[model samples]
Target: MSSADAFQQLVEETLLANAAVVALVNNRVYEAPPPKGARVFPDVTFGPADSDDADADCIDGVEHVLQLDVWAQDYGRLSSAKRIADAIRKALHRADLALPDPYALALIEVASIRAFQDPDGLTAHAVISVRSIIETET
Candidate 1:
């Protein structure tokens, strides 16, 4: 699998297996935002990702900047989304995680998190960014 694909898979698995995250989203973590009609609140979806080559000294690698969005609806607040975002951060930040056999995760960390209400008036969204470096296993 491509590095980005493997990275997402690693993240999705890590989130799904986390009790706190599962309790909040209940397997609602998706690689992409689900269709609008099928979306459930308090979910985490993979957002935009930027991957750039990190090759050096003949070693192949990638620096990946990825985002996970937390969705919730609490007309008066963003607390729920915030909580989910925290859980996601805890589950991933500085955590040692395994990738597919072809790849090795060199580092993973939470970059930043932002919470806000969508213009729709009822949707609260939290965006969590994660950065990681991955290298192919020889």
Candidate 2:
């Protein structure tokens, strides 16, 4: 599996998990570097997945898999990685879904949360990977 594949899968899972949240918010938003208050965030985009990569199946014989890659712009400056993961989990659980086993989807792992000092000051980014397998009842 490549980074792009992993990233797309994570994206799909997150959307599914937070369908309700998305509907309520009216727009998608990522946590951005705070200058205290900024009405609009800078233009940011999630690049497309690599052309050659493809999605993968779950080891437990799951048919469908959903994966998500979430990150803040200024990574590794502030914020706790675990807290970010918890936030992602909460977002997912709110829609009545749960993340799958980590071992099943091994792509971009949440190694750590770090802070970077920009010219403006210090900023934080929380990169997270989440997955959910589509299980069938036998």
Candidate 3:
């Protein structure tokens, strides 16, 4: 698999393993939309990934900038969405993720987080930016 794909899988697995996150999203995490009300209040989505080379002479590595989005219909106060964002940060920040075979996750860091009310007014949205370093197995 590509480094980006491996890193993404690691992230999804980490979030799925977090009990607090599961309680909120109920594993309704995906790259695409799930059916409405298929799970719970807040759902997590993995957004786009931007990658660049972090390669060295002997080691081939990649740095990936990934986004995670949280959505909820909490109206005025987006407490639930905020909490879910926090959980995502906790799950990924400075984490040592494990990638699929032939790839190794060197590090993962939460770069930034932005939360805002969507134009629709009813949905609260949180976007999390994460950076990850992955190295190919020799």
| Model 3 Cα lDDT, one tens digit per residue, 35-62 | 7656555788889889998998898888
Q: Model 1, 69-136: lDDT tens per residue?
A: 99998893899999999999999999979887789898999999999999989999999999999998
Q: What are the clashing pairs of model 3?
A: none
On residues 21-87, what C-alpha lDDT tens digit does candidate 2 reach at each position? 3443223343332354553222111322223223345333232223233333334444433344455
How many clashing pairs in candidate 2?
Answer: 10
> What order do you get sorting by TM-score, best first?
1, 3, 2
List the global CA lDDT of all models. 0.91, 0.37, 0.86
**C-alpha TM-score for every candidate:** 0.92, 0.32, 0.90
Better structure of 1 and 2 per TM-score = 1
The better candidate by TM-score, 2 or 3, is 3
lDDT assessment of candidate 3: 0.86
Prediction RMSDs, each to the true structure: 1.5, 9.2, 1.8
> Any idea what lDDT model 2 has?
0.37
lDDT measured at residue 74 in model 1 versus the true structure, 0 to 100: 89
| Segments in model 2 whose C-alpha atoms lie over 4 Å from true places | 1-26, 29-77, 80-85, 93-95, 98-122, 136-138
- Residue 117, model 1, lDDT: 91
